[model samples]
Structure formats: C-alpha cells, structure tokens
Target: MKHLYTILFLLTGLLSATVSQTRPDKINVILMGSTHFGQEGFYKQGPSMDLFSPGRQKEIADINKQLAQYRPDMILIEREPSEQHTVDSLYNLYTSGKLQFAQLSYGRAEQYQFGYTLAKQLNLPQVYGVDFYSSLPTRLMRDGKNLDKFIEDLNKFSNLGRSFDQQLKDGQLSLKQYLLKLNAPETLQATYYNIYINPARVTDGSFGKADKTVDTARIDKSHIGAEYISLFYNRELKIYSNLLSLQQAHQSKRILLIMGQRHAAVLSKILEDNPDFNLVPLSSYLK
Candidate 1:
C-alpha cells in the first residue's frame, strides 16, 4: 500500500505539469496601414502630411506611443524575408540608442518613421519582413480596347483616397482616427469591393480565354479580368505565408502588423478566416 500511494502521487504531479504546458490562447493581431515616406506612390501624389515637419513628426511620435501599449510579442512589416538580415542590422542600431532610423529596407519608408519608433518604444524584437512581389499577368490598361475606360474606372475608385484626405483636412479625424478607420471592418470591405473585386468586372476582353472557370459568361472568348485579380490575391497569399511561418517559429501570442492601407483589407480577410488568430480591431488600441 505504501508503494501504491507513492506511485499515485507521482502520477498526479505529472498530470499537473502537463496541464501547465498546454498551448497558449489565440494570438491577438492588430493589422495597421501606413502611408509611405516618399509619398510618391500615394495616388500618384505625395502624402498629405509633411513627414519632416516638426508638427507632423510630433503627431507620429504620439501615435507610436499609443500603439506600444499593445505589448506585441512580434511585429511584422511589408518587406521580403530575404531582407531579414538588413532589418535586424538596422533595428539593432535603434535599440542600442545609437540612431533614430535605419537606411536599409524599402516600401513607403515606414521603417524610419513608423516602425522604428514602435519597435524602440516597445522594446520588441526586430520587425519581420512579409512582403511578396510579382508582376501582374494582365494590365488594366491595354494598348487600345478598354484602356481609356480603365483609367476612368480607376480614377473613380481613387476618389476614395481623395475623400479620406479631405476628412483629414476638415479636422474631423485625427491621425490616429484616420489610421484606425483604414482597417475598420466595413472600410476594408468597401475598399476591396470597390478597388479590386469591382474593377475586376471590367472584362479585359478575355473572360473565356483567361478565366479559370468555364461558364456561359466566358463561353465567348474575352479578356477576363480574373487573371489580374488572381495576381493581386496570389501576392497577398505569399506574404501571409511568410507571416504564418514567423508566427509558428516564434510561437507568437500576439502580432502587430503594419503594411500599406491597400493591403489591410485583403490581409484582414485572410486572417479573419484563420481560427488561430483573434483579429483585434484597431479601435482597441487606437482609442
């Protein structure tokens, strides 16, 4: 009986230890969008705010402070995995308090203005690069055909950007408010629908020839715009794959993702369907 009692005690201890090692809860991901540093790519124009201006710099500083409260275990950015070395080398300089920004990396120059500030403030590990690049298989503007129409439709969609800029000018929305709005559920939905999915309907005249699907709509040979849409969707998938790899490798409990506003909606949709993540709204932290 003494031996039996000792064995039971050891078994109980093993069970308790096993329970303690159970996997953590879903990761809380905050996907935020940013305007680039050069402002060249923003609607073929420049950023509304002057990044170097003292007033604008102060605004960015305050926004980074608020975001640091999320306490993310990992931060992801719009960069390529191959550039990880550059990201690490640059991040090291900022964390050591040696400098304010790193010259390496690309895309909208957010690393200096937005990323470095958040990483330093939170004392986070170096940001991960998850951007994937590829050429579009189908161009919206063909040599002749609906090329002119493409411009008209594209401009109509670009109006969304102008509308957002006007809101900022009116002072009805602060910088943080505008940033949060970029990723709001409804806003993302509208952006994707109007920007990608809707324009894809333009039937680049290859509906039957290019479409992966075989339907009466494509029974007649036409330049289906689906091919172009696929390029957009495929690129996002590759980027998301990089992020997934990082999450698993680090066993991250939370991730703060920063990317272009155009990408926020598509990425949010992908993450929304994944059971492993709890898509925390920007409002939770922005407010």
Candidate 2:
C-alpha cells in the first residue's frame, strides 16, 4: 500500500507539470488600425494623407506621444515576413541616425510613421513584419445575376470610407481625431462588415477562375461569397499564425500591431477569440 501511494503521487506531479508546460502564457496585444499615409499609388488604393505637412507632423507627434503609454515590448507591422531583413536594416539605420524621414521614398507609410517611430521612442531593438498576402479573386462571377443593387450599396459604403479619409486630408479632422474615430467600436464593426460580410453576400459564388473556362460541374453555387472571401480569411489566418510564431520565438509580453484600419478591425476579432492573447483596446491608449 505504501509503495502504490508513492507512485500515484509522483504520477500526479508529472501530469500537473506537463499540463502547465503545454499552455502558453497570455500575451497582451494592441491592434492599432491606421490610415495609409504614403503616396496614393504605393501599397493600395486609398487616401494618401501627407505626413510631412507641418500640421500633420505635429498631429503624428502627438499621436506617438499618446501611444507611448502602452510600452509594448514588440511592435509588428503590415509588411510581409519576407521583408523582415529590409525592416531590420531600415530600423537599424533609424536607430543609429543613419536614416532620416527625408531620405525615404515611402517614409509616409504607417510602417515608418507609426511602427518605426514608436519602436525608436521606446528604444526597442527592431520592429517585426508579420503580414501575409494572397491575391484576391481576379474576377467575380455573377452568372447572369444582376449585382447592380449590391454594387450600389457597396459603393455607398466605400464612399463613406473615402469621405472619412477626405476629412483628414482636408484638415477638417486632425490625425488623432481621425484615428480615434476609426478605432471606435462602431467603426470597426462597420469595417468588418464592409470587408467581409457585405462582399460574402454575393450569391453568384463565382470568383477566381483561372481562365474563362467555366465548368458547370465544379460550380459552388451556395458558397460563392464564402469561397471568394476565403482568400482574405486565409491571409488573416497566416498573419495570425505569424504573430504566434513571433511570440513563441521572442516570448514578448506585450505586442503592438500597426496596419491598415481594415486589417486591424478584422484582426481584433480574431484576437478576441484567441485564448492565448488578451486584446487590449486601442482606444484605451489613444485617448
């Protein structure tokens, strides 16, 4: 009886140890959605607010000052992982005073304006790029379905976004105000709907055909929108995975993600459901 009792106690201790090792510590995360500040033609189609303007510069400086409160151990950006070397090199130059905003062609970008700026302020080593890109469907299939109404509705939503960007460009809204508005719960929800749900409603289920050869047998009529939007889902999944990989390798306690507000909105939802992360509200620090 004594021998059996000793073995049971040893087994219980080993099991508890194993369980503790398998569960990762929760990471504090901040998903900061940003407007692309680069030149219009660069990255994607959106507003290109000039970051060099005296007014805009002051606004950004203040915004940076506000975000500094978070004191994240790791800063991540929307650039692809393959560009890690480029990010590392640029960050090194910035930290060493070898690189200046005037010297960079894409310096207006959030990667530089936000990510690089904040990392330098905190005196961190380097910023990480965890973005993953997959091509969106080239052609949307309606199969004789009239999408005029849907297109109109989508246009209305798109115009709303454009108008919001226009507000900052016209100086009607300051950069900090713009960011605050963008990060609001209602705005994030709307962005999520516009990017995913609204488009997924397309009934045609016809997107991303390699050529014009349509085989009726392979058509997925009931899931066209879901299938089409899966490209975006796949991209976000890989991005989230990359973040996890970074956390595992670095064991950072707090992380800040700087990306387009749309990506931020989508990623916030993803992080909210993840047990390993405690997603902090951007508004908490923005204010």
Candidate 3:
C-alpha cells in the first residue's frame, strides 16, 4: 500500500509538471511603433506628420481598421508608469463619455489616436501605461570640440530620419517597405546607433584602450558610451518589466503595445525573449 501511494505521488508530480508546461499562459503580443504628432516643441523640431489633417486621419482610421482584427484584450500606451492612475481616470472618463478624446493633451498621439480608439472599438476594460522615464547624464570624457561635433552629428541623424520619412510620404516606398528598411541592421546603425550611440563612445574617451579607429561601433563596458547605452536599454527593460507585471493577470490574452518607432527594435527583442509570450509580427497587421 505504501508503494502504491508513492507511485501515485510520483504520477501526480509528473502530471503537475506537464500541466505547468502546457498551460495556455502564452500571451500574444503585438507591438506597434508610431511617430508622435502635435509635439513639435518637445522634439525641438517640426512634426513628423499631421495626424489631425483629414487625409492623415482617414489613413489612421484605415490603419486602425486593420489593427482591430487582432481584437487585443488590452492596449498599452506610451505613458509613464507612474502616471497609471491618471491614465486610468482618463480612460474611465473617455469610456463614460465624460471627456472628449480631443481634449486630451498627454499622449494624444498614442493614447487618443491608437490606444483609446482601439480600446473603445474592442470594448476593453482598461489601457496600460508601460513607459519608464529615466535621464542618465552623458558627458564627453575628453574635453575638446567633441561636444559640438556630437550635437552636430545628432542633428544630422535627425535630418536623415526626416528625409527617410519624406521619401515614404512622397510614395517612394510603401509603409511596410519603409518599416522593413528602417528595422534592418544597416538602417538602424545608420539612423540610431551611429548618431545617438557611436558618437558618444568616440568622443567620451571611454572608447577603452582599444583601437578607437575601429569602424564598427559597439558598446563596451565601463565607459561614458556604455553609460548612455545602458540607460537607453534600461528604459526598455523597465517597459518590458511593466508589461510582464500585467501579464499573469491577463494571460492567454492578446495585447497591443504602442510606442515610439525608435524603441520598437529593443522592445521587440525584449518581448521575444520571454518563453511564454509570442511576439506577433507587425507585418501581419500592417497588411
């Protein structure tokens, strides 16, 4: 009888393990990278697109129509995690029709246009704020003209991105083609890594004792460049962490996250790392 009981216990343990492995806790995640509108002064530049224009609004409506088929259970917006309560209140007001979406200023690009609209269309209960804000001090390790050079390099990169977008607007490339091109490793290096990351390492004196002339820019530890890069990733990590914090409660559900276009690569990588969460391709919905 004792042996029989032991065998039953062993079988139960195996069954439990199997259940844990096979449970439908795997979440379906779709991440959308969008350019913000109506915040020109914040970027110290002109708007990327006129989201409020009739043509743009019609385009956005069409995009939302495509996105609605995913029928996500929750939508995440580009809002500071600390502002969750405020977002909750706003969402409730919007749902209750007490507040018009047009009156909302914060996260108007993401929350109003994409998130709230998606939520309302799907009858979702809530919208999530998953963004993390952190500013890490960056300085030139070598005191020289490097500071001015770095600023100039950053401005150049901004212009490059604008030019790339203009090409799309001019019908030189389809939206999918543009996104595919932008997400390419070469393109990421040309746009993001070259300007924001590489310049700092080259000028920060933390290029380490290695050959500073190395053309391929990569992150090295214990340097100012490394410091800036860490903060950049740290924010993404925090955003993913915030997403995970909400996952168990919304398991086996479809979630859509809206964030800045520049962050899509890092956030996509982070979400893809989770064994249980399947990161859905943006291409699938863009069609």
lDDT of 3 by residue, 76-161 (tens): 98888789898889888988989875575644475687788778888888898888765433332333325566656667767876
lDDT of each: 0.68, 0.77, 0.66
Instruction: Supply the TM-score for candidate 2.
Output: 0.81
Clash counts for all predictions? 10, 2, 0
Q: TM-score: which candidate is best?
A: 2
Q: Once model 3 is optimally superposed onto the true structure by TM-score, how far is the C-alpha of residue 144 displaced, in angstroms? A: 8.3
Tens digits of per-residue lDDT, candidate 2, 87-150, equal: 9999999999999976987888888988999999999998999998654542454542444555
Tens-place lDDT digits, model 1, residues 13-80: 99866433232577778888765654544423434444554655777888777777778778888779
TM-score of each: 0.75, 0.81, 0.70
List the candidates ranked by TM-score, beginning with the highest: 2, 1, 3
Candidate 2 ranges with C-alpha deviation above 4 Å: 1-25, 41-48, 137-146, 208-222
Q: Which ten residues in a row have the lowest lDDT in candidate 3?
A: 207-216
- Cα lDDT for residue 116, candidate 2: 95
Compared to the true structure, candidate 3 yields what TM-score? 0.70
